[model samples]
Target chain A: MVVIAHPAIAEDSMPRATLRAILGMRLQRWPGETPVKVFVLADETPEHATFSKSVLQVFPQQLRMAWDRQVFSGQGQYPEVIASTQEMLARVASTPGAIGYVKASEVTPNVRVLKIR
Target chain B: MCVCSRFAKTTASIALAGCLLSWHTASHALDLLDGDFQLHGFASLTLVSTTDNNLFGQSDNQISKDFSEVGVNASWRLTPALQLSGGLLSRRAGGTDDGGVRLDYGLLDWAPMSSEGGRAGIRMGRIKTAYGLYNTTRDVPFTRPSIILPQSIYFERTRNLTVSADGAEVYVERFGEGGTLSASFAYGQPQTDTEAAKVPLVGLDRPGKLDSKLAPDLQILYEGAGNSYRLAFTALRLDLKYQPGYRDILQAGRFRLTPLIFSAQYNAENWSLTSEYALRRTSISDFGPYFYNGTFNGQSYYVQGTYRLTPQWEALLRYDAFYADQNDRDGKDFAAATRLPGFTRFAKDWTVGLRFDVTPQFMLRAEAHFVDGTGFLAAQDNPNPQALRRYWDNFMLQASFRF
Candidate 1:
């Protein structure tokens, strides 16, 4: 799985820690003051597990706990959940400052693949 | 009678609204400001029973359904750097809390400095206290590790003083490759005017009023390896003053509590381990000759483990212990001085629980606890101290849903 972002995001690559924070919903804005919009597939999805473990190097449960702690405490919000990789691609492509994940083979021209350093 | 009916009406209406919204597939809706506005809520009910002592109600012999929580919150991200959020909670915990609706948290979170590397922010208004790990979200069933948190640290009787405060907090975080380190400091007036808060501190609902000075709380946390390892330290102080009522035998008294807590957790695939230890110093003085006055250092600690048997099922085991005074672990001195049972000063509990995730939005849980003492039982639930037992057993079943 590879992380993808809206083509409008200026940075093609970001530090892995920053990427993790973004996906965890702790980081709310991208550089240049663009509101960061994160999308994710359902927790049970294999793609979601792969993206959380391999790409973000965190367990899905950890991510869920982090979101719950923040969301319930009114410190942050949950990411918009996409139904499938198809919807994930479409959302990331259309939504400014959007970030999501897609299989390497399914990468399309609509969304820009983000590289983790 | 009129106010009671009005409250019932409001609760029924909100519950109806929540049920209607639960039917919507998407939890987030009304995305008014380009999806900046969001609403969420949760409802949970529990059935509790105990062999000897009442908890959250008269649960000594039969099941009691007096424990429930309902909450709703809304947030609007007005700008990338600023957001406003608030929530209302209606909690019923038998005589301690009468299911009254109250503001859980309402804060304007502003991050003047923000970037991928880190962010520093200030929250002003009614902000949740960052106590231990679970205190901030303790009311939310889904966020808790068990149906009832370890009473050793999160005292339900004194919860109002620690749950949230009316004031401001400043926080800073650094997102690094090795881990995430964050720290916060808050100064606020704790909620001490409630009957629930009064009973715990003074041992009864005194006619006098209890007021707290501005309390200061501080916490530092480190999350390592994607939260595989978590550690935290917290320090807090609460100073309270009581003014006696008309013809009141008690003089204007002073009570002070200072607690230092250390918490750690290790989360691994399929299983997790967590523990917290606290040292609390309590002092009460100047209640004329009518009340006991002294200083004591209390000790509390708990170790808990949870294992996931399946993707949808989880199991938990925990050993929690508490002592009202470390020097009098068995309460011998206290019992001799007051003629109260020594068991009231200490508790040792063994708990086992199971959780089933029926759906992403719904969950069911059951737990059983065998307790050796009544140290943590709320006086409001069991006003008669002589009725308490040295040992008891408790069982609880809960159903919770959120959207």
Candidate 2:
């Protein structure tokens, strides 16, 4: 899996924990005050499961519960869910401060690959 | 009196439904204000049955369905540095709650400092108290581990006092390479109008009401190992006064409660373990001979484990214990003096529960408990303390839905 970010993000790499925080909805903004939009495929998808375990190092269900608890409690919000990998790539590439992951072969020049620090 | 409260609850439910129905149209307009505006809600119904004692209704030898919860919340992110959020909640828990539409929280969050390293913010309004891991979302069943929270620390009898407070809070967060660290401090007036709050603070039949002054609540949390390990510490202090009524047996009283809690959890793919310990120092004074006006140190703790039987199924086991007075764990001295049952001052509970997620938006849960005391029982549900038994069994099932 390849982690991708919007073109405007200056840093090409971030700690694994930072990446998890963004996807977990704990960190909401980038350095420039741009809202960090997150995109992901359905939980049941193999690509999504693999990304959640390998990159985020968190269970798929745990992530879902975290989002549910935060959103319902008025403490935080949920990350935007993209239906498929194609949409994930397309949207992340277009939206500023957006971040997502996809198959290595699906990587396009529109988005920059983020290296795990 | 019972039928009257039930009728009022039904009317309130209808009113809540009406608000939700109208929000369907307003939901679209919310986006017009700002694309970031979001509206969310949830509802749940629970059935309870017990071998002895009434819980949430006439649960003794009968299934009681008076337990239900509903809530609606909205948030607008005006900017990265500022946001406005609020929610309304209605809870029906046997006779303890009246099922009225209550404002849960309405707050404005302002963040003046922000960077990749961390951020600092201040919130003013009705802010939810951060007492422990589950206090913030205790009313939301979908976020809870079981139908009922661990009564050891999150006692239902005094929920109004610890649920939420109206005032201001300041918070700071630091995002580090190792983990994330955050802390918050709040000073506010806790809600103390409910009978549930008055019963524990003074007496069950007190004609007067209980009022709370500005209290301070502080909490700090640290998450490490990519969010697998979590730790938290919380300190809460409350000061309350009693306003007497005509010919009331209880005189004007005052109370001070300071509780400190330590929480920890470790999460893995297939299973999780969590435990929390609390030390409570409570002092009551100024009441005449009608009540026990002394200071006592109480203790409570619980250990729980959850296993993922499958992707859609989960199982949980927990041991929760509570002692109203740590030094008087058996309550023998107090029982002999006050003529109350010794077992009433402490509780030992063993629970096993199961959860099934029918879909992302719906869930079903079942749990059973074998309790050895009446310490945590709601006083309103069991008005005649003399009829209480020392041992009891409780079983509950709940179905919840969320948007």
Candidate 3:
């Protein structure tokens, strides 16, 4: 279970509206962009593996070409990776704009946990 | 030098012998207590070629015929919280004997506080600069596909020796149901060698001289992600002064605010895009001794979009532009000074490219650039004024691999 978020942004304060806005920017989605979802890896693995799997689950076929398109077009970067669950929770607790998930028990006073489904 | 070479050869031979012995020993039996404390090393060779006619204003022939570099990276994990690592580089451009080596990352990490999801650790030794969002991750082989980094943002050198300081840092992170945040702080003497006086050349040219002094610097960074968005900010401060070789130089011991960058990217199944804008204030101190200081304010920005056509192929396009205040010399703005070589001070570029991912760790990329030069070059006092305009088209291809 990773612990993450800004030191100040409390979990409850991040309403759906704020979460949407923050994630929209982090995810680089336009105002009326289509519905898209994100996920977090609970177990520890290589950072690249986590990124590849998360992205693959969302857009399986696009995974082959999406990274290159992003690099050349400068649309944005792939998702970031953390070393451990504790690191994830700490990052979420201190970062107001960050959204990551860990084990249910890891939830702290700093960040919110959003369900993928 | 002879002794050093001899020593290196002997060390290599010893290492080879040790490897053979280890192979034989392992084949005989699985001895739990037979593990020996041994030193090991690894090396890499890179070959690069460019088809662009002229790059960054150097003569077409000045391009590297076939740029090759050899380097050794070694590491020893002494304990769960302690390790030693270093690297050395030598390239054909400079003879093998002209290579340089330095401690890459050697530190004692003490994680006094630990939890399933969080830990606070202190690391000391030769620490790398964690300046911007990408600085810490820049050296990873898989980070980017190009041989040339975004020069505008990162200096290509492997080590800023002057800035690599002996110091300690504290890091804290928290991961919640939604996102994560992490923060760190460090203090140390600059690593690169500096001099009190130096001549700054333009473009990729090396400076004629350098100052010798170690200045302390401070940096702060923040990154976060929500259900749909991510945000990051990096700030740095350094103490220094700038004096052009010729002109009424502006000198001040102040922190030059290089720029504050804001970047965001959205991910979707079929498509995604990213945009970044950075604004920096140019003071007299920035235009050191190479050329005259003219218009002192400048800003640069770029936006790009990407669409995945298929699993193996993708397309991309981007527009980048930068502008500077017109040269103000002797109370006269050089905006209209066509007769003077130093009158221009603005520039812009546009680029498009494609990528083919052959595998997860390998990719081929090609990009073309169309650039316009407004004030990039100083005018030559030639009879024909039309000769002052400069422009060029550039093309690049790169095959990158990582493990």
Candidate 4:
């Protein structure tokens, strides 16, 4: 869903915080590093681009391995897979501590848009 | 042992209660279970087969077979400051004896001091030995595709002692802007006899008579940006005092052995590389002049890369080489020897493979290895003058799951 970061971040900054947290930090500490967990946004939300960029920055190898393992083991449901940025923003706004990225034009008062470095 | 059993039972009972309460609440209310009772677990299954035309020069070389194994792991947060975790592994690769459940890891971690930026804790029980950068993280089957672990750093002899020490470890971690720094100190008597017999060699030798003295081990690790590193050192000293018939052996010997290991890894978008080197030295007092006393050095290096062609498919390539002073001496057949004296040589392998990530939790990997063997040990023992080839090849496919 639509992802948002603190307003302190610049609009043109890279959307890399989520990527850094998932790849650079170990899983045990991931929850403490960010204010929100990642989720899919409703298609109506404006913050789709930021969420897409965050996903793009993640190490593909780690993501593939983690998802493949989780899906095969039948332990739990996979994270909600979304196809559009508007949907991501919609979900992020409704969900607390929910973070995702959207296009700069979609930025609104409902959620804080963070700058990616 | 009784206390440990009671502790396990009590923990299980508590977990069951938490699960029941959560189920009732979820059925009647909108809230999920108390987030404090965190439940996490993972499971994996693998199948392997090998084909050989000539079994390492044996008369009957044609052999092929397939086998599978399953592993399950669970961890529970008993409280804000305490946690309990354990794993069970079962395999049918070798025979009936090889297909039994074993406790992979079981320990209680207590964080006496913890905050958003840092934590200090002590863990006790059957803790995994933190001897290298990978040891603590090696249990997750999905972390690597290969069925066989890197042999150079984690030798075959060391597996039996993979989990050791009825002791405690104190660890501290600090989070910085770029990454984290973590360090730990551990001391205690190893729980199993396996760690003791292999003393000088780590886990190189089969169990024999055991020396029941307390052994000490220490390790530290650091991770930053795209790199992770580790340094470890362990020492053991034994006095052979029991056998009166071998009084001379007692006087001829006090043994001290130490092994040092250093490793680093860098992960990138489509490739990851890891390398490690280790050195071991042994000294004995009172052994006769003919006793071969020298440092047995072994070194191994490997680099691996992966490319994602699509969301469901990927390719991998790797090369590894290992060399050890088999003779414990510099020169060829330098003869004078003591302790487990043998020859020295090197082995190398180059591998290429592909993996299909069919789903988030399942993957199938296929790889082929071309191996070259060298050194005095590669020479044939046969009196015949015919030359023997010093190379071989093998192929393997594995499918695994982690949850």
Interface RMSD of 4: 7.2
The two-chain DockQ for each candidate, comma-separated, is 0.77, 0.54, 0.05, 0.12
> Could you give candidate 1's per-residue lDDT for residues B1-403 as a string of tens digits?
5348545844774575477475545544545566688778888889999999899988999998888888888888888789899988888887788777889999999998889898899999999998998999999999999999999999887898899999999999999999899999999989998989888877785789899999999999999989999999999999999988888888999999999999999999899999999999999999877787899999999999999999999999999999999999999998998888999999999999999999988999999999999999999889999999999999999999888
Residue B146 shift from truth in candidate 1, angstroms: 0.7
The clash count for each model shown is: 0, 1, 91, 48
Among all candidates shown, the one with the greatest TM-score = 1
Q: Ten consecutive residues with minimal summed lDDT in candidate 3 chain B?
A: B30-39
TM-score to true structure, per model: 0.97, 0.95, 0.55, 0.64
Ranking by lDDT: 1, 2, 4, 3
Tell me the tens digit of each residue's lDDT in model 4 across B1-403: 3345534533453354346446545764222233322233333334333232222122113332323445554454454456665555443332111334566556677766654456678887766666554454354555564544455555433344444455677778665545556677766555334322333231122223434355566666565642322223333222221111233322233445455666666656455566666564445444335334344654555665666677577777777666665443332443233222222245566778888877765678777766564221211121121232346565666776543
Model 2 steric clash pairs: B56-B94
DockQ for model 3? Answer: 0.05
Task: Count steric clashes of candidate 1.
Answer: 0
Model 4 chain B is weakest, by summed lDDT over 10 consecutive residues, at: B376-385
- Greater TM-score among 1 and 4 belongs to 1
How much is the lDDT of residue B156 in candidate 1? Answer: 86
Q: What is the C-alpha lDDT profile of model 2 across B191-240, one tens digit per residue?
A: 98778788877757778988889999999999776667789999999999
Candidate 4 achieves a global lDDT of: 0.46
Each candidate's B-chain TM-score, in sequence, is: 0.96, 0.95, 0.62, 0.68
